[model samples]
Each structure stands twice: as structure tokens, then as C-alpha cells.
Target: MLENTLAATYTPGVNLKHNVAGANWTFLLPRFALDTIVCYGVPGQKALKTLARISNNLVIVAAEASTQTMPPGVRLHSGPATSLPLPARTVDLIYIATRDAQRLIERDGDACDELARVLKADGFIYTEAGVSAGWLSQQSARLGQAVRYWLTPLLGEAQTAVPEVDAATRRYFVENDLFSSSVRLAAIGFGKRRQPAAEAAGDAANAPLRTGGRSGKRRLRQKLRPLAAALQQAAGRVEGQVHLLGKPLARRGVLIGPEVGPGIPQYLANIAAEAGVDLRGWRWGLAARGEYSSRKVLIFLFPPDEQRPSLIVKMVREAGFNARLENEYRALRWLVENGIGDAATLPQPVFSGYHGGLMLVGETIIDGTPFRAADGVETGELAERGLNWLVELATTTANTGVASAETVAAGLEVLLERYIEIYEPGAGERAFLAEQVDAIRRSRQPFPLVFQHGDPGVWNVIVTPDRRTAFLDWEAAEIHGMPLWDLFYYWRSVAIDVSRRQGVQDALAGFERQFLHESPLNATLSLAIRRVCDATGLSAALVRPLFYLCWMHRALKQATLLPRNQLAQSHYHNLLAFCIEHQDAPALAKLLLAGRAEPQVSG
Candidate 1:
């Protein structure tokens, strides 16, 4: 719920689209083989985006066409909730807000018969109605002692008085990490309802929801969940606290990871100062905190008057996280020196130094809005921009010699071996993985070596309204990697996030649609792929192989970060496994194996 912090950063592009109902979709969507879904009343844009992506027959029902808004693929039906446009027992899912439920209620105060008439027996009507803002305040006092409230003051933590905003309850989201968009997480929130249409027909248990038709007393917790930490206990005035420059910075909650020392913040401020940046009154927020042992942390120094962060400070949490920060520092310096910074819109490095054996690198924040997924046209444009930048970087940094097939195979094999070791796949899984590696080897292909933006996930990207894109988080970049890694990675990353809430199979279906099927965006993606191959003398035959190999590279990277048992939980592991399982699945096989023009193996 870092809405405030994200707003301050100017990058809350699509994150705001998600709401309490959208959160419910994580568990809700995966349960059904959805074809027809009636979004009763107006749900958030996130639900529509998700519904549109998963299935085509998403009909938004409302009182009138004038009252409802329709996104790209969905239809709009003018009707009351009591009488849906669809036939009986047709819709696999019915999503309605509790207020809408109350509005549809007759003197009987029950509206589920019409809803039940249209929904399948096994289908779930996922209804989420929120309590009042006052309810949140009342519950804040009842909050568990999750916040010891403060760590040591020496670590730059402080408890301050509440700011003017009523968001002391926000710390609950922070401690809970409600900002996470990960799909597999099983955490359920308070007052969420999941009932069958048949079962809910006569239920009065849901009547309490009908009592408040949003009479100004009710609000979704998601909408009111501000970005703050720790409510004020004694004065009954809700307040949150965190320290900025060792003094109490009112209202702002502690973000990810603890500040190492009082001197570190000063040191970061000093770097910005030396770089001619004046952040006297700027608020410093911890944007990311990595694994426990490898606590690499990212701190954003938000300028008081500006939308974009003035400076971003990244510090090493431990020895395991050291090299990447150092690599990112070097990568930024190299790009700036080589004049490739603007092509990709990379950050400008300000200063680098070691404090207490942990490395901290300060860089000027890239100014733009974060990229939003689910729209093919915009994503297509983003793909073109990202791929075009990759081409320029390759031309600048590449040796321009044919990449040795043996060298490529060796690196691919190392990734394969690591995957086997970490994931310990079944025999079929292992054989499919080996066959994938062998395909890369058999292709006597000599692909161009490109400077890869290792993890070009959409979240790492932020764009100006004009579409001038800036890429962030360069810790995973490679000096000389296989061509099209960034392009493929960008598309896969976006699809994974889009299909994530639906689970592994949903991701596979999305992949098939994107890579194999003749999708609207596929042409855009295909053209971008062709541009890379055209620029580097690479073949289309290598496209399928390279696409498969990109996941291997990601698998290796994730293995280094996540522990053994948790590696399977990683998105990359699941995607890689699912791809192998469907190796010969009709569409993918036809796409990958057709027109088998060979690029010769070095062996």
C-alpha cells in the first residue's frame, strides 16, 4: 500500500488498479475453469485486466451502459444485478461488491436467487465488502504485537507523533508486506467471504453485508490502507513513526530493512550533496529489503518538491549480496562512459564507497512512470523501445565476432546442471531439460553476443508519457550474453506477472498465446525479435532455443538467491519446469520445431 511513497516516486502506474477484490482473485481465479464471468457492478480495473487476460467472455453488468466503463476485450451489458443479461447457470464466476448486493436486495433482503440462477454449482461468488475507516481505527488498537514497534534506536529507528493523516493502521500492511504482488502467497485477510451460489441462496450470514450500502461509513481497507507504520497508542490519535537522518520523520513508516547506522544516512546524503544534489528536507524511504542473510537494501531519497526520487542509495546487507551492488555500480559507470546511458535511459552513478565492509552505491534516480502490463499495444511499444536499446548496446559493446557455439553450450550446460541440482527434477523433467540444452548444442548456430539487461521485468522499467523508457536494477546485467535475452526476458517477465495470480498452468496458457499463437501483440513481439536477429546476423531458428535458454539463465540467478526448498517456489523454477513438461505440446512444438534451418554447432 505504498500509495503515498509510490505517488511521491511518480511510478504507481498500475499498482493502484489492484484492490481488495483483486487480492481475492489470487485464490478466486485459480479455482475455476473460467469462460463466462459477469462482473456485477463496477470492480476495479485490475479485475477486468485479469479477466480479459484469462478469458474472453468477461461481461461487465450494470444498471445502464452509460454508467459502466469497458476495457479492451470485455463486453458491457445494461441491466440490473437482479436480472443478469446472461442465461441461467451460464457464468462460471460472479463478482459483486457487498454494497451492490444490498442495492439489489428486495424486501426479502436476499438477491442471491438471480445470482445463483446464473452461476454454476461449483462456481464461487467472491464478495468483498469493507468496514468503515472508523472500523480500521477501532481494529488498530486490537492489532497484535507484531510491531515491537521499534528496533534499536542506534539503527536510526524512531517513534514519532502521528502526522495529520489517519494512517497509523498502515504499519499493519508494512509488517505484513501487503504490497507484495507475488501470486503463490497464501495469506488471507480479515472479513473476506467465499461462498457457493447454491449455498449462499438462503444464507442470512451475508445479511450483515447488506446493512451498509456504502452509507459513508464503509470503505475498502485497500483504499484506506495508507503507507504508514505504528499507530499512536495512548493519546488515541493515530500516528506512525520512522527516522530520517536520525531525527523523527513524522507519519512515514519504516520501509524494508533497517538502516545500518546513523552515519550511513549521512554518508548517503553527503554523496548526493557532493554530486550537487540538495535533499535537505527530502524523505528517505527503504524501497526494498532482500533475504535475511543477504540483506541487500535499496533506499529512495525522495525530494521534498519533486515527483521522482533525487537519489537512490543501495547498501550491501551481507557478503552474499556484495558483488551485485558492485556490479551495478560498474555497469552504470560503463554505460555513462560509453555514451549508451540515454539509449536505455539508465541511471547516472554519483558515488561509490564502502562503509563497515558493506558497499553502498548512490545514483541519480531515473525519472519516469513505472511500466504497466496487460495492454498489448503499450507493451508492444515498450518491447520495441527495450529491444532497440539492446541493439544499440550490442553494437556498441559486442566484439562483432561469431559467438562460439561451444562457449554458448558450456554456459547453457552450467545453467542446466545448476537447475538439476537445485530443483532436482524428475526423470522426464531432467530429460526434457537435457533435450533443451542439446537443441542449443545441435544448432550449429553462431549467435551474436549482446550486453544483456539481465532482469528487464516491467517493474524495473519506468517510462515518460512520451514513451522514453528508463531501465532500473542492473545488478543482473551481463557484459556478453546471448542475443535476444533481454527481449525474450522482457516479454516473459510481463506475462509471468500478468498470469501469476492464476498459477503455473495459467502462465503456460499465456505463454502459448504469446509465443506460439498468432496473437495481436505477437506481431509486435515478432517484429522486435526480427530486429534483434537482423541487427546481429542471428537466425529465426535460434529464437525458440534462445527463448528456452533465457529461463535457464534466470534459474541460475534465482538459485543463488533463494534457498534450496524455496527455489521451487520461485516463479522461474515453475515456468522452466512447466515449459519442459509441455515440450512437445502441439502449439509450442509446431512453433519451435518448424522450419528447422540449422545454425551449426561448434562441435
Candidate 2:
């Protein structure tokens, strides 16, 4: 019977990593023909492969979706650790392989409860118990001596003790009388104790008393409330749709829900259906969750099946930003019409509209992955591609307008005022910024505006395995902006990446020496500048100041909006320092002098 159960439950074809400690489980497989096994947390690939060879049914659950495809018979479930979609008391064995067991338990105590509840009588639980040096001293002498004797040689003379198990976990298991054994680095096992019939009955009898004499009633009421609310919400939505039938829907500002719910998928499916696209076989999974901002941007993926190509559904929700989606939709259409970039490099907009206060955009998924500078691409090659893209964007689009010196100066002052209000800059810093603003105001040369991708960081660009690049996130694209702004911004991102990889001091020092022509990065910058100058007949002198202006603009903008962000603060401070050191630079020097002389601008 055990052999049959093992054969029925063993999963096949799982590949496991060889380095994990739990990979030794293969030797123990002969002892028990387990009926069901669950690999929780991240298990070793080698261990999983060995388990698959022995077990027919294996389930792997984790917080994030697996990047690799699962082999046949192995199932992957993604969700918070606190919840697992499994029947109670059905699992025969549970394996949790993680370095920090206490952290795991603390993060999701309910998961531990679920593990206990699901294990059948006599079922086993295996985990890593990483205890420190004094850990054994606190335990029973017999167990402590045995563990210390076994582990002492492994610890060596320099290392007198090592972590063996977490105190809280050991107590929980010991108090419950479930701990079976401990050997080497692997904690052996625990079993669920079967409850006696009389004890169970007594507990059942006292349940109502524990709940103030309304156990069943309270349970029933709690369960019914959610169902009632769901039904009412569904009915209201249906009525709202019916009422809007054949009527022009008014454009309402952005609407946002506090949390994402099941209805989101259905709402998106309805939108797809309205656009004559069938998504009946599609399953939605979250692709990305953005940082804290008023805008809630969620990217969801619809994996390709037999009938349709893979699709990406992007939803942007905010309290009052209704026009962002509209802007993106129009920008995409314009890009497609102008053939600004390769067809595959651009998002093919399928359907875009607003629903339930969300700005929804469905586009064909790009088959590429996000580009990383460390991915073996030569620095010059990456810079060339990025610069070429900017050039293409600038040259292909017609000039919208010329932004005058006064307009630029006024904008900088507004941003500076906001920054001062939030950051409370020192007297010297405030005076310096005021002078820089004045210098910008003094420069009267107007730069021609071109359509610009407002945010062009490496993360926003997707690179195919074959080295093809495509840009994403067009919601912030501006129709009228200096072409050099995008180029300088892209350069700033590369510099930041370099700073992150190499020490900040090294990168900043490199920037100081190599910004114009000496550094490799400067070569790319020079090439981009030369190309733009050739294309637009703009002088290097005229455009040089614009780069500094662009950096200041970005720094001020980020500082004003995200005052608490240390990274933004660092960038702002760095820019100020750079300006102070290089005050001889024409545009920046003028601005600094002006800032020092000008009266403080009011909020």
C-alpha cells in the first residue's frame, strides 16, 4: 500500500540544484513511500529532481513565479506564503528549505499553521535549524552534547560554535513534543499528533463558549457578509453598464481602488471582448508593481496559448490623472504612423480605454527582456544604440516649438522654489541655486523642440536576445521639448548605473575627467552631440549649457516630488557640488551668479 501511494504521489522530471543541503533526501526516500510531498520556499534543483524520481505528485509553492518552465507532473503555485490553495490534512510531507526559518515563520505564521493542519497523522515536516554557538547549551544535556560532539569537528578550532536552529522554532516543536531528531546541518523531522476523540468533542462543545455563545452563528455571519457585498457590487456594476448603454460616457478623472481584486481580470476581459478580441483561455499574472506614487501602475501578462499571441495589459490608476492613458495611446499611434523605431521595438497598441476609474491599455507583449549594462554589451555599443534611438526620435518628429530662455528660467525657478520649500536648503545652497536660475534667465538662445520620450532609462528599454531594442512607457512623452534633454537624461542613467556597479566616488571622479572627450562614455556623448549638431546645425557651445540645464531640471524635479528619497537628495546635492566646482562653465556660472543676486521666490 505504501509503495502504491508513493508511486501515485511521486512527481517525475524535476531538475534540482546539487548544492542545497536537502538534496540528500534522495537517500532517505527508500525509508518511506510518501503519498504526497510539498517543496515550500526555494528547494534545490537536484533535490527536486531526486524527489521527482521517487514521488509522483510534487507541488512547489513560492512568493514569485518561476522563470523556468516546469517539467511534466510538477506544479508551481505562486502567492504569499501565508496562504496555500490546498485541502487540509491532505499532504503527507512538507519540506521547507530556507536559511532563515524564524524570518519565514514571522512573515507568515498562518503558513506554519497550514503546514500542521495539512499533514496527515504520522506525516513528517523537515526544515533547516540554524542555531548559534550557545544554542545547544540551553537544551537538554543529552541532546546538546550529542549535537555539539557531532558538529564540533565541522566547526574547527577558530570557529568554536555555529548556528544550528532558531530558538523560537525549537521551543515551538519541543513544547508540542513533535521534534524527532537533529543531525549535522539538517534538522530531522516533526510529526502531527492525532487528537483524541473525547478531547476533540470537548473542544467542540466549548467552541460556542469561547465565541461568547454564538460560535456557529458568528461563523455563518462572517462567511455571508463577503458573499452579500460581492453580489451587491456585481449588481451595481451591471446596472451602471446598462444605464450607460448607447449613451456617451463622460470622461471622469482617474479612479483608484485601494487594492487589486479578482474583478480586475474580468473587467479587462470584458474590455478585450468589446474590442472583438477573445481572451477566454488567457490567465492573468502580475508582471510588475510600481513604487509608492499617487499613480498605481500594474503590468499584467497574458501568456500565449494556441489561439493568440502573448499580450500585455497595463493599467494606470490615480486619483486625478485621467489624461495619462490618453496621452500614451496617442503617442503610440504617432510612433506607429511615423515608423520612429522598429515595429518589434515599439509596443503595438491593441486597445486603449478607461473603465471603472482605470486607464487600461492592452498591447502586444515584447518578446525581449529588459537591458542590463553588465550583460556583456560593450559600453560604446550600448551608447551608440541609445543615442541612435534618440536621434531617430528627434529627426523623425517635426519641431513643435522653440522654448525661450525666459520660459526655461521661469520653470527652473518654480522647481527650485518647490525644492527649497521641501528640503530647506542651507543659505549657501539657496544662494547658489538662485544664481544658477538667473544665469539660465540671462541666456536668450531658444532650442528647437522635438517629441521626446520623457523617461528613457535602461529599464524602460527591452532588448531582444538578438540585440534588438524597444522602448516602453510613453505616458510621460512630451510633444515639445529640446531633443538634447532625452540624450542627457539617458547619459545620466548610464552614469548612475556605472556608479552603482563601480564605487560612487570612482564614477564621480571618472565623470569629472571624462565628461567632455577623454572618457569612453564621453566618446559616446561626443558622438551623440556631433550627430545632433550635424542634423540640426546647432553649435556645440549652444547645446552644452542645455545638458547642465537638463540635469538641474531633473534633479530639482525629483527632489521636489520625493523629498524623503535619499537617492534623489544625493543626485541633487551632487549636481550642486558639480556646479560649484565647475562654475567657470558658461551657462551654470551665469545661473549661479544670478541665483545669488535674485530675491527669494515666494511659494
Number of the predicted model whose lDDT against the real structure is largest:
1
lDDT for each residue of candidate 2 in 469-497, tens digit (9 for 90 to 100):
67787766776655577876677556545
> What is the lDDT for 282 in model 2?
48
Task: Please provide, for model 1 over 492-591, each residue's C-alpha lDDT reduced to its tens digit, 9 standing for 90 to 100.
Answer: 6555443432342233455655655655445555666665666666656777777677776555554543334344544456666667766666655555
Question: Which TM-score value belongs to model 2?
Answer: 0.49
TM-scores for every candidate against the unseen true structure: 0.53, 0.49
lDDT (C-alpha, whole model) for all candidates: 0.50, 0.48
Clashes of each: 6, 31
What does the lDDT come to for candidate 2?
Answer: 0.48
